[model samples]
Target chain A: MDLPGIVHRAGGALLGTLQHVRIPGVGQASVTDDPATSARRWRAVTVLRDQAAVGTPEAPPPPLDRFGDRIEVRLTAAPADRGTELAARFRGTPSEAEIGELRAALREAKQLLEVGEVLRVDPQPHGQRKPTPQGAALEGMTEQAPKEGVL
Target chain B: MKAATWTGVNEVSVEDVPEPTILNDHDVILKIRQSVTCGSDLHLIGGYIPFMRAGDVIGHEFLGEVVEVGKEVRDRKVGDRVVVAPFAACGSCWYCKQELYSLCDNGNANPGITEGLWGQGVGGCFGYSHAMGGYAGSHAELMRVPYADVGTFVVPEGVSDTRALFASDAASTGWMGADLAGTEPGDVVAVWGAGGVGQMAARAAMLLGAEQVVVIDRVPERLTQVRTHVGAEAVDYTTTDVVAELRERTGGRGPDVCIEAVGMEAHAPGTPGIYDQVKQQLRLQTDRPTAVREAITACRKGGTVFTLGVFAAMVDKFPLGAAMNKGLTLRGAQVHAQRYIPELLRRMEADELVTEHLATHVMPLGEAPEGYRMFKEKDDGCVRAVFLP
Candidate 1:
């Protein structure tokens, strides 16, 4: 499988590489209008797929439409040394349109520019992921509505 | 009925194991379909475990085909495929009622005694040593269990042996570790041992939602397996200061919960070369509790420390001060194997968990001694070795 592509980043745990940058009209709206960050600069959810090869040979790397790749996001507040985790919504997959943006966004997002393994596609899926029926094509696992007012 | 006795450490001459006859209405005879070794079995070999005698059938982890049941036993039958819940508990004891079967009162000297109740006491384990209930273990093809219906669990259909085999001990022990750790969603949890039990704890911790999981061990191959399969950040304690590394990963707070999977023979320096001088002595000291020390020191302040590994006897001079000062919670014990088996089976059915990777080595029962040595030496990826007897 390809290395886990960076879905997005911000502060604290989100402090690493700017792995992907999703800014398509729908993705942008998803990030800009998320309830979690309705009044913030960016409320984006960037998913870190366990591998570059999530679904099948033909399946897309995540942030797919089914799982809500349209995430809320935010750029970290200044002072890189402050060490706040940068986080993003870890759901869904990216469209073909966003993969390119993801690469560019990663180049622009590297805070240190020295973290060795930038990106690599995986040959197989790892862990508990299910394969999409159509070879590698996938819609990604849908997010369940949080049960009864819970996370 | 010929009773089986401990021959020497692990060498049991099953030539004269007693044929158990009906006792209480709850007794059942098990024609063992599968019997095997446990890490606790190692305690006997190391002579670290207490109460052991020569000629005891040394095994507590096994599943059986029930050949007979007592008049009082109704739920189980002659043809049932069952896994013994290593810890025996009387069905209605206080601990049994509360579901803490391992701590049952009215406890017998046999490890499989079933007087279930809350026990903050120090006592027995089945088929292990003299200290625990000294009931003969299942190294042979047949044995008997009292309170059979309550203590024996059914292995689910369609679940492979690789999955169900550990339900009796290793899997549940790991679950105990994760549960005691109070795993939180998105919490950073670090598991200190990557044996069968440690791997399960890490996976269980993930099922509970630890955002970043780290596994520390000395074996390069084992660390690789955990990283490639479970995706926990790997730390080779031999090459790095585990406590310092965990602090660096967690921004100095360390893991929310730290689990000690290495148990009594916790080798302090990960790479495993120097013989522990303490192991040479009968008495255990702070230096003897290497893994315990690592686990305690590595845990985040205010975090929970779970000891899934079993020590022969309690050790001394623990950084209990750290536990008290850090306000950390410490919990240790052999697992209540029966309590968690059904839930684990359900998760396995749902495709939510898989334990197949843990079987780094599998051999026929004839190589049982070799399997034990390899495991003790931790050669290759011998994290867990299963004997297909």
Candidate 2:
């Protein structure tokens, strides 16, 4: 399926010098040069639409294509030069740090659109709850208890 | 800034932590006025709901004044008094559009952990563990609120901070339970546990036009509060056979609706309680379903069982046969605070929902560790603890 104009721009700006490559399970990664920017700056868009893409366009298609209705990840690099330009064009002028933050934000945005929310992790991983006998017993004592057969 | 942070299991300390800043365009920073310890916090501090990290600021029910707003924040501004819900929901998501804010698709920053645990991710909650969303909680002087326009509601005039505070979680959760249970005219509703949520659920049942609301609790003070303040009949489960008593109270049929407000960490009185305790202690089960089991068994034929408490994982002895045989419907959920906050505020403004009695212990933020201890131990009849920063 042909990528949308915005997707083309985002992919080109985010991933430098796109190429057509097939990765197992993730579907196709198609690289195309952006006409809006100079070729010397390595301005190219790489769209990695998943196999799950139905080919029917949504009103506003998801930020990242879905992988089997669950997992979604953008695995390409766009150039920093066009990244700033695109950020200013759409999200207002962002600082360099914000531009750096934008990539992560876009990745999270894709996850949210595809899987309902972004995955979170503790700043520092504290291990599981203390497994004392009373603690374990009380752990099971919930009013809105989780259903059986789930961990 | 001094805030309460979780150090370890059953161990929390008020320590100096860096103040929060506006991290996103839609974020707002609040100067907290009042932050309260919820019953659910007990689960976190006790290490029931895993995913807490060392030094994680832990609190969700709070009221504060807006001190700063991000560039894209539209409705809220500096100097607005607001009560923020525990759960953070993006207003534009599929679940939020459907009025299921707790199930908001795009709210939780960390959905992978929850998806692994519950098959699908729920929404993000403040001061809850990373499994919910590692967002810093409200127990500090300055805190950042994301999606402020949707989750933060302006506390109207004439509603006291004490009354408005419970609206954040307890009141909203209880109201949602009653709403889900479909409490209607001439219906008899039995609520298990008379903590903040229980008391509120009992009151909500009455507000929603239940013919008779009975609150069950082993604690004398909670039972008395439910009867005297909520105007519901109180049943002391310790002193009576709860199932038999419920059947007798409802003319030999169970109450039309049963609401379980006491979450995981239920206390059972006798042999069955010990049986659940042993099974859970041996790592055979993740939930001690004393209240849930009882609710299912005691619910009238074709009645509804609503679980309002927070449950993290699996449970043993579910009694699905009883549910199936009697044609009973079971429903449970985390509170969708955004949907009910405005209406609850209206009720508080009119003095129709009394919540001041629920805040039995009001202390400074410095004494939060002590407050948590008292609340956890149920020391001196502490139903809820309010912390002023």
Candidate 3:
């Protein structure tokens, strides 16, 4: 990989680590779970629909169903008529990339079930992006944003 | 398409950016009519937000005509004149269901940055920054609005484009502060800024039956507008002791509700102001809480203090002890424009909410750089520099 490519990836990695840093007033509570435990834990999205309508774990929605037997999917009712909690976890210890994919898939599934379409942002509108390291770093952060969060 | 963009700190540039297209089925393309500069946009322009990438489009409050709509869109079509909510909230989200549209879970596509900063993702705001959603702003000839059914409101025929524009964000935000802060009839309400939002909040308070409404600001023109246009009394904080004045006016009870419409880059007079400025410049604090602190201090015992301003992060010396001791209720939110835009438009139709005076400077999109300069410096009595794209 080239120098700029490495720096961009480093910026993304920095964003990935931000969720784990515990700052009393500035940042929220840190996610302290070990990587293996974190990967094993269920990542869920609350879809504002009925459990039956969200499809069974055996036959989950499209992008989620793509994971197939490689992951375990759960469909449960959310309280107060909010929706159904669609959750998934890798059957085995998954790599960081796999977990990121899972996160994106769950978000997409929720959006598709609720709004009937997933929202898109890129290729919308913008001017020139000067090739500064800081701009690249921000681009890296935004590129990694969809796959990283408290979800 | 030509668009106004944040090229660098304290700089705005007009660039030939690609025109936006429908990205979601619920999205609509707007041929922007009037997009105004918001005070919150200053934070991004000054690089206080830190999330704005160079060349990012940067205006949110606007009125436009829909030229195109995605197939799934309902209640809106081509040729409809509309004022859109700043936040792109899916109507089906739990937060949106509760009328808290700004907190819609699915609105922001890139939630990680904000989830990391604030522990939870907020709904996306158009043209704010990448942290919000990176949606192109209204400062362009054309822009895309997501969740069109939920966020965009049809302008009543009688209301002028200039009158319905503020209903998008400033009016909605100000009304939210007054209503959520629980301004009651015969109550004394004090708002601590005379910017577009502050002036609107004063108007909202009066309409909500507050007996006496006082808007505080140092800007002579804004203060005059507060008295003349909003029909609220104005207080010049530079010459008056704000706390003392509120106490005196309210028969020593202080204001029943205090709203702070000034955000992180708040200006203050004298020593405390200097201290905040120095600390902010030195990076000890991210925001200048001068107005927020005063609001907490000046609020009556058991009164509510609502911040209608846009604050990014933490501030030092927030006067939490005073808040707790006085039993003050503190609240703040991004403008839930969808919740109040309808009624605000109706008020605009009746000519009760006058926002045309707030558009003190109006120009075409090509002159955005100069317009932003006038707005940032508060030069030429520029309340809001409205851009016709």
Candidate 4:
């Protein structure tokens, strides 16, 4: 790979590692669940709407429902006045890419249900992008941001 | 179209860039009227944030005219002069409903980056880094504002563009610190750092009925502005002991409310300052908490210490013990501008809050490189450099 490409991948990998590393006395709040356990864990988003509006597990919103048979969804009332807790998990162990897709989907579903549109940041105005490795790494980090958080 | 961008650390450049367009249904395209250099921008420019990319547009506090509004935008329309909230928050979120718009869950598009850094992602900011959602900033001829109906407030007809410009971030952020810290009438309030936000916080405290408001700073020009413009007493921290001064001025009780407007890059005069600078340079800590520590120490027992400043990740040598033992209410948040902008505009319209003095230097967008330099160095007594895009 070219230098920028290598740096870019490293940036994304760095983000992935950040979520699992636990150094005592620092930012040590990351969850270090094993891959299998993580795959089975239900990722949820609290949407500010009624549970009925969020639909049932078998008939969840667009992005969450798109997971279909591969995932088992759950919808419950979030603590008083907060809204509905929409959650889902893969029935079987899934690849890292699939988990990332679910993360992005959950976020999108929340935005769609609340704001009626997913917030877009790309195709926006910017200055020249010099092919510096640091800039490329930030690009890679942002590109992986949607899929790499604790959620 | 032209925009000023972060070319590199401590480097800003003006170059041809694409004009922003409506991306979301609630978005609006703005013709930026006035964008100012904030003290927080200095941290990003100095690379303390470490999230800014080269060529990324870099500004947040601004005033603009709505040139185009998305289909779903109801309150704002084309030709409306508005001051945008620094953080883009969706009004429907639980956080927004609770008047904590800065913590809106739906605002940040790039969540994982900040989530990994801070454990939870906050809202996105315009022209802030990619970690803040990579939104193009207002330091351009044209820019995009998301969730316009919630984030953009119409400028009162009686308020000048210069006066309304700061209501976007500085004034709102300062007001949040004072109002949220529970500043009460007859309370003695002490604020650290007399920058734009610090000055505004002092003014807000006075407006909220603080009996005696004192602003602490080492900068002579800023201190002068504090006494002359803000009508608050000023302390030169370089000469006076901040903790001792606060206690002495408050009749041995210290201040009821202490607000820190100086962020991670706080300046100190002695060994503590040098130690923090060296530690931050070596990456032992992400922020220098000089002002925060002083605030905690200077606050009265059971008093409130509010951090209006921004801190990245972690800080070494924090005075958690003092804060805990003193029964202090320690709190901090990014600007909940949406919650305060409307009232701030009303105050501005009434000429009760004047911010035109904050614009120490006004220049065109193309002069942003020089403007940032002057503002960063505090050269020519520059408090804020307002850019006319």
Candidate 5:
């Protein structure tokens, strides 16, 4: 195999291992597509940890490669759980979509374990269309205006 | 399907919209039988809430019959009549478990916008702006209700649609205000405004064993309703000095609990209201806080002040000194309807909570735009405009 193909395969294998290696207190969550998945393969991991020690773990910067692969780590405190929560996402290639899926699974698993349900909202991925105050009023009166849903 | 949609500031129209379908496993489609214009809807129609889009459907207080149910919905079935809470909640969330349904962590469909606006997102509310989770509202032929088992309550067989409809928002919110204020036996409770919410709060205080309840508003008709319908004393702010009158009525001590049901758009008769109006026009402040200011000033020392009104953003000249010096306890929240709806329903069933008087004007759905105008103007003794679809 070509050198580039070898490196890509090696990266994919590393991500696959990272996806399943569950740390104590942090479990594997469900996987879902990130809104930006189409532009760049992004994956996230949610970790449940002691509230005080949540962000203690220093996140290493996204690993760089010739294939334009990257990873980002984030931590947020759960409001009611009184615990530390960690989420990580990676962007890479040669099975990047698979890695993204795995990351989503991990995030969902963490939410389920901590909150007991997957948070859901309508995915307005296209973002909001800025409405002019006057234009919005006119559009609202029109019968052909597009309808938006609360997910 | 025809739905009352927000066209712009002070603009609403009943327009043809697409029919809602069951989108999730726990979802249900409801054919709306009755919907009401809530005071909070004024904030949306007035452009006080920035997250509203041009074509967003508006009207959250509703009673409907379930026409379809998703596979995951276990408790509700088609043909069952139900009243939906204004806000959507995911029952398994930590907040929901604690009975804080309005603060459900996972309910907002448009969390990104809300998180940006409030530094954190709240649960989704029907027909509210996108910040509250842009779910289509109930002033329509049909609406898709997600997590149906958690958010909907089956109407009792004997409760009329008019009486049952207030349970959806106004009654529940007012009951919650009294509940938060810790209304007790022999305590004097004062409620500001005589709108649907204000009337409900006054009635709720009476139900909670308050010795006396007083409702304040400018409209003579509403005050009359307060006196006759809700069995509470009424005060006309325009004709009398509110703080002075409150002090005199409470034996010079002031009310034990003061509830502010008049929200951001509060108007003071004199200079303060004019000042707030000028500031609001210049984008200096978003809320007038006229009633809240008076509520704080009129509350007894060490008394509890319950804010049941909806204030979207910051207001100028809040009397923090009175709150601090008087040792007053101030609490406010969106109605966690799920926590209080069942109990309120029980009260309704027992004929203790009468809500039919609040729905003074009932009209067809097609005249919703006119309804909004009349309700906004408070014309012809219109407390609430009920829309029969």
Candidate 6:
């Protein structure tokens, strides 16, 4: 559908506004609109890793070393909210290629469903047992036979 | 200088005293060439442990040569080197049968045991007052030990008497605290207090496979010792907000286990001894001193809190409801000295654990008063003070 113009514009504008600039302080960051619920949701992650800061001349931050392995991220959204933003956190633990692949997979899943159609995103496809109801709607649901109990 | 006695508060002396002979067929007369004062000994002199009086021998944890043994005691010899686990058990009661000998059921095991001492008909202890179980301690040149066969462990070769002494009480208590806290690899463990027992618990946690151990202490020297030797991180609870610090360290989930090594004297005069009700108190709030509280507050959901310290004689209340609410299991116990000695000694023999590092000062038995003062004030990195009688 030769829509490079629209896709690049959306990606570029979002990237420019979000790059490297952190809020003065983020209070109560929620993975979902209601973080109280344990379901899939769109997530916000912050860049906390700074390999350059360790053993450097700075006095070290009070909340220091929360970089790299200690980097923080949270997920939000649910099958009831629609599967459009399922496993947004899956990108945080992957390489560049893996993240691109995950993004493409989410896009494909979104497209496979009708606009506003419901879908269940298995938050941890690799985890053993049960698909999270995510934001799936019963109608227009692409129910694949669950693979023999996450085995 | 062959015998020890309490002359006054913070005063002790060695005098020409009668030597001990086996009274029971199960008894052993140990010629104590070495002995030591514990922090609890201060309780006896200051009258804090309650019901202690003049002529009471001082010290509880020590190692020595077995000078004589009765006909019923078969395992030990006159010359055999042994480390004593001062707590005794009846070995047949429900608690003892389950290998929980420290909680043994005996006629004297009851609260009314002020008739004489603890464990007289049930189980007994060493070096504590008549309220505890009127048994003489090892901090003397001569001492009589009832139930000697069950309480003393033979020191294996190459494990010096210097090192084996702690297998009696401090080291075992620490190991049991870590064990009760359910330590596992990759878990974060926080121990409150850096006393002899606290540091030992930290070391035991490391040996049992905890990935990180955070030892909380106001005493700088003791904390430094723990950080340098046991690989445990340190927390100066005096200035730092301990609760916030622990939460920050543990992925906001809290430590996997928290051990209370501070027992009663976590704060000053009002609180005393180890805690039995900390099992209940831990349910209320997690805090620094009453490590049981901190353990409850600091543990991850579905974690374990072990109280190894002895609480004073008040039926204090704790948060049993919180423990249940948080889905936590809290265990209360005194050290099972009868059982853990051999296993602990093997670790020492293999050089896998060096408990002697805990012994920071040593003096002749006459200076036990000085030893008592140093340990009570916690001077000179005073984790342990050994008395060579």
Judging by TM-score against the true structure, name the best candidate.
Answer: 4
Give the better candidate number (4 or 5) by DockQ.
4
Better of 2 and 3 by lDDT: 3
C-alpha lDDT of residue B334 in model 2: 92
In model 4, which regions exceed 4 Å deviation?
A: none
The residue-level lDDT of candidate 2 at B369 comes to: 93
Q: Model 6's chain B TM-score? A: 0.88
Q: Model 2, stretches more than 4 Å misplaced?
A: A1-151
**Candidate 5, B365: how far from true, in Å?**
0.5
Q: Residue A73 in candidate 6 has what lDDT?
A: 30
Every candidate's fraction of true contacts kept comes to 0.00, 0.03, 0.78, 0.77, 0.06, 0.00
**Who is ahead in lDDT, 1 or 4?**
4
- B1-389: candidate 2 lDDT, tens digit per residue: 88888878899888888778776677898999999988889888987776666677889999999999988789999999999988888786556776889887566655435544454557889989766767788888888888889899999988999999999998999999999899998899999999999999999999999999999998888988997899999999889999999898889899999999988888999898898778877867666789999999999999999999887776777899999999999999999999999999999999999999999999999999999999998899999989999
Residues B1-389, candidate 4, lDDT per residue (tens digit)?
98999989889999999888778899999899999999999888999888888888889999999999999999887999999999999999899999999899999999998888778888999888888888888899998999999999989788999999999999999999999999999999999989999999999999999999999998899999999999999999899998998888888999999999999999999999999999999999889999999999999999999999999888998898999999999999999999999999999998889999999999999999999999989999999999998
Error of 4 at B110 (Å): 0.3
Task: Write the candidate numbers in order of decreasing TM-score.
Answer: 4, 3, 5, 2, 1, 6
Question: How would you class the docking of model 1?
Answer: incorrect
Expressed between 0 and 1, the share of native interface contacts present in candidate 4 is 0.77
lDDT of 1: 0.57
Candidate 1: tens digits of C-alpha lDDT, residues B153-192? 8778877767777777877888877876788888888888
* lDDT tens digits, residue span B42-138, model 6: 6566654543444556667888888888777877889878888766554433455556656543201112222111112234466665444455567
Q: Which of the CAPRI classes, incorrect, acceptable, medium or high, describes model 3?
A: medium
Docking level of model 4: medium
Q: What's the TM-score of each model vs. the native?
A: 0.66, 0.77, 0.98, 0.99, 0.79, 0.65
Candidate 5 residue-wise lDDT, B72-188, digit = tens: 889999999999899998776567877989987657644434433344457789888866767788888888888899999999998989999999999999999998899999999
Pitting candidate 3 against candidate 6, the one with the higher TM-score is 3
What is candidate 5's TM-score for chain A? 0.29
DockQ score for model 1, please?
A: 0.01
Cα lDDT computed for each candidate against the true fold = 0.57, 0.74, 0.92, 0.92, 0.75, 0.59
Clashes of 5: 12
